[model samples]
Target chain A: MIKNQFYVISLLVILSMILVACSGGDAGGTSESSGGSESEAVTLKFFHKWPEPEHMEFYEFAVQEYEKNHPNVTIEMEAVADEPYKDKIRVLMAANEVPDVYFSWAGEFSWKFARAGQALDITDAVMNTDWKDQVILSAVEPYKLDGKIYGVPMRINAKFMVYNKAMFEEYGISEPATWDEFLTACSTLKENGVVPLAFGDEFPWAASHYVGDFNAKLVGGDVRSADYLLTAPAEKLFTDPGYVEGLARFQTLVTAGCFNEGPNGISHSSARSSFIAGKAGMIYIELEEFVTVADGMGQDAFGFFQFPSGSGDEGDQKLLTGAPDGFMISASTEHPEEAMDFLKFITGPEMGKEYVKRLGIPSAAVGAVNDETALPIVVKGVESINTASGMALWLDTDINIKIVEVYLPGMQAILNGTKTPEELMQEVHDAAVQAQSELSQ
Target chain B: MKRKFLNQLTPYYFLLPSLILMSVFIYLPVVENFYYSLFRWSAIDTTLNYIGFENYTRIFTDDLVGLSLFNNTLYAVISVIFQVFIALVLAAMLEAHLVRPFFGTLFRNILFLPSVLAISVVGVTWQLIYRPDTGLINQVLRAVGLDTLTRTWLGEEGTAIYSIIAVSQWQWVGYCMILFIVAIQAIPEELFESARIDGANAVQQFFRITVPLVRETTLVMTTITVIGAFKVFDIIWVMTAGGPNHASEVLGNYLYRVAFRNDEMGYAAALATLLFVITFLLTFIQLWLGRTGKEN
Candidate 1:
């Protein structure tokens, strides 16, 4: 009798454990299926890549305000840092645990997810609604693929040559408008014992930005797009000599002692620190970082210029290196209506103005980042992005990732002086060919 | 007969939970990994194209695979030299009473300090220490007027792998030494005393007794070091990210890059399968050699 009681008790314990293990998910499902009434109480899972305290402050405020307004909805939020977020999102998608709303770059990065049917098609919701008029059209353009929008742009970002004005004036250097003048300025800075450019290829994306900018100016937009989309024929695919010339120009910057030593060893933040401390003359920085620069070096100390154009006119010199980063609703969300509502609220004009004021990023929402809400430099940056002929999306995101894999490391090798421009281009050409084949498949 | 059967079944009943967990977690995924390896798939997409050993063929021909394998081999060999062999000598010295009592504990604690640190922390700390301009190593070299000897420790192709391997040694050698120390402590002191009385010196007794007695521990440590070397990912990932053009790429890092970064799930599955085979074969060989040595 005692032994039988013990067995019965053990079985009961195991059953209870299993029940406890499964209860949380079951409760969520039950709540989800209860009703779509106003008091139904929906839980939306939100994921984003900004976990930094500064960004988090804005995000937390936005979430709280949204939740307060919609008492029936609750947001379960999760955030990861930028780099790990890229890997983590894929894992989550693979595990079928994608959050209802998430952050994504508005390029091949988000396009891949959209192509895989993992992202919701928000085209009708964005275009048919008043949201279309609220955002800058240019910023919203990148989110369109195959004539449908998959994401809503939140911020407009672009790269610029931000310099310490005091140091530049101390060395009698002015903003360069041409490649030759830029090189001369670098030489002058080097002679003055200041690092002309604070370049860090540790992440390699920093180098890719330069190459992307150069390629845009040298290779032209249409040809580059043809190559990027792998729509060009085999003979013309990434075989442009201008591609080699673009890499060669970057190599010239390296050979001219235009950057800090062992750039491949340094992190971008460390390089930014050197620039902020007046140890480096200038850095190619994104507009989003202008606020951080202002905070570090006082609002009046720094000035910005577009990356100087080379003498070549093969490409549109007015093309700026940048794209909008935005948010997407997952296709698998159980609460699509609620998820879309939250995305609209978070990316709307009010939150966008708050984004600029609090987080210091230029908002994609039209007229959200005036002088009152943003720093003077940020206002100028937004104007530049607005007036540019077109935005050159980041190389790492704009191009096919397989090709990016080659371009990034190949650029690092150029920084390391281990591979020549011709050699690197050959590798890039081969990768483009492979990408073309994969596209056909 | 019923009681006997019940007694016999009790051990299996006790093991049932663990066995089920292992099947669900470890064994199931491994089988699924092999099945997925034969198909071209992406993690985000629900499409799977049956590609039948094409990924395996690609792995054999891939230059990155060859480079990663070479790096893994280099790591294993170096780890064996430092963590296994050198740690054994250090453990033997500690057990031989060469140091005073107070300092012995101090030294052991100092040696084991790094192993307790998180791998991410260690990788980050070493990255700061290996910076070309402001890093500790370079700063020290410049301070002593040995600037020529200073190099980008974790940046350049020539130095990145070696620098990462050195950090691995710094973190793991102590742990391996502790294992050796424990094994050495378990040996009878009377054996050493008898050797001493038989006209054997410290070196002679160490070779004849301590070394022989700790053979099993040495085998275990060597196998662990080798497997750990092959499985290295966090340090390399956090530090160089298998760069200045993949100078420090290993199998695990390459697998992760292909799977998550490139979204090539099938190819990554193949790479994972290859990694498992390599580790399994090496462990089998080591254990087989150990058994043969015991038999002899």
Candidate 2:
């Protein structure tokens, strides 16, 4: 009888232990506090992608300042690095545990969130109010989807060919003004035993940046958007002859021995290092990376040029391959007002100035960067961004992710000499058809 | 009769907690995964369209699915050859008292050191060693005036999978060797003495005695190696991310790309189901073979 009683007691203990383990401990008891009055203490969970110390310093200052101004509101902040943050945010959204405010890329990345009703519609807060006037119009344009504002722009970024000034002077290579000149310069550098372009496609998104630029320039924005958004008919999706031509033009650079050998194996950072070390004469980099380049090769050692215009006059030659990264409020936030206030605060002129001063990137907030707050090259890059005909968002983020997956690998195949431009475009077209069907469903 | 019945009931009562925990955590998710595999859903989307077997059919038609399966098979086969067969041979050598007494422990420890390090650290270190221009391999090849023979070990499609597989072997061979060592040590010294008396040479004794004695360990090791090869993600993710155009893509990496990167949760779930079925069937076959061997 005693033994049987012992078994019962032990079983009960074990079961209770499991039950305790399985129970999710009160996640800060936020649910109860939610929907409370403005005077009541409320905690807003904030998430962003910049976890590196250099970026984190700015966020920490912004949060501290925001908290000081709103003592009743406690901000619980979390951050992850760029790549893993995408996966983490998706899981958070799926679990319906999205933070009050989170960082998001400006194109289809945020659009998918909007379509799912996860991103709050801030049309009134952004457009109806004076907030829209505070940011660069072009910077905020990508965040506006289907006539509704979904996100607030933070930093403006664009790609350019940053060249070594010394190497260019020695080789007598002036900033190329056309595709033919660019090709000639590449051959000249290659003949001189210098890597003409430092490129890496290990992450594949690096390849997508080049392709995005070429596609935007060759295929034009309207046609690319129609295919990217899957609004085009099945026969017309990604079937543009200019897309094939754009890919072929990219391939011409490859065949001319323009890029560093075994580029697919090298990482973007490594490629940047090669350019900084003067092993490569040029590198296609984003405006945000100017700080790193300036740090590595000295501010005076490099000069920037837009990728020279192609001979084909098919698309907007002045369209820059770039976008503004920004923050969005969760649609299901109980404290939409508080979240909006937080978004405005983080993306306001003060934080934007700090963003440029500390991060050396151009802020989307109007007049947030100048000679005093940012590097000379950053200021110049921003000027170019402001002057361009338009901005093309990063292809990997702008297009449906399924099609991007095919396009990325196909681009790598082209680099490896395994697939032709026409062949890859056919595969891309097929993927687009599939993506269109999936999107419709 | 009452006491026997109580005793039987007591064991079940003690097992109830574990059974419940497993049911909730493991069994429930697996069942739920199967149900999810039949739907079309994105991670963030609220809608779940019931598309019965469409994801499964898509899996059969996807070219990446075929390539990934082939890569996984290649990994498994190579792992079996190096981690199991070669490890067993090395263990026999170490146990046979062939090495100098002082060097035996030294060699074993040296070999086992890689397994002790974190896999991520191993991956990063190997990536540096395989780098194109400044890597250790290329530097050595260039130093030997064999520059033409030097290639980007982790970059080319022809070499990327093999390079990743080589890293796995470097890290795991020692672990398998240690396991075999333990198994070989368990056989009584008297048996070897008797075999020596019968004039059995070292090679003959290894084949005739040590191999037979360690059959159970070999089965366990092979099962582990094969399953582990199929589920390889971290090293590949850290090294090439199954890239140079998916040349090194295994089932695990493909599933993750579909689920997270592509945001096709249903399709990923279907891929997960296929992985589970393959591993399950392989394990069942292995266990059955072991049992039949025992019976014979």
Winning candidate number (DockQ): 2
**Clashes per prediction?**
0, 0
Name the 10 consecutive residues with the lowest summed lDDT in model 2 chain B.
B95-104
**For chain B alone, what TM-score does every candidate structure achieve against the true structure?**
0.92, 0.94
Please provide, for model 2 over A1-441, each residue's C-alpha lDDT reduced to its tens digit, 9 standing for 90 to 100.
Answer: 888688778877887887777564564454545555888877889999999899989999999999999998899899999889978998898787999999999899999999989999998998788787788877878988898999998898999999999999998999998899999999999999999999977788899998888888888677888998999999999998889998998898889889887788888998999899999999999999999999998999999999974575678998889989999999988888999998888888888999899999888888899999998888999889888989888999999998988999888888888889999999999999989987876
The alpha-carbon deviation from the true structure for residue A297 of candidate 1, after best TM-score superposition, in angstroms, is: 1.6
Give the worst 10-residue stretch by lDDT in candidate 1 chain B: B95-104
The best candidate in terms of TM-score: 2
lDDT of 1 by residue, B147-195 (tens): 8999978778889899999999999999999999899889988997788
In model 2, what is the error at residue A238, expressed in angstroms? 0.9
Candidate 2 CAPRI category: medium
| TM-score of decoy 2 | 0.96
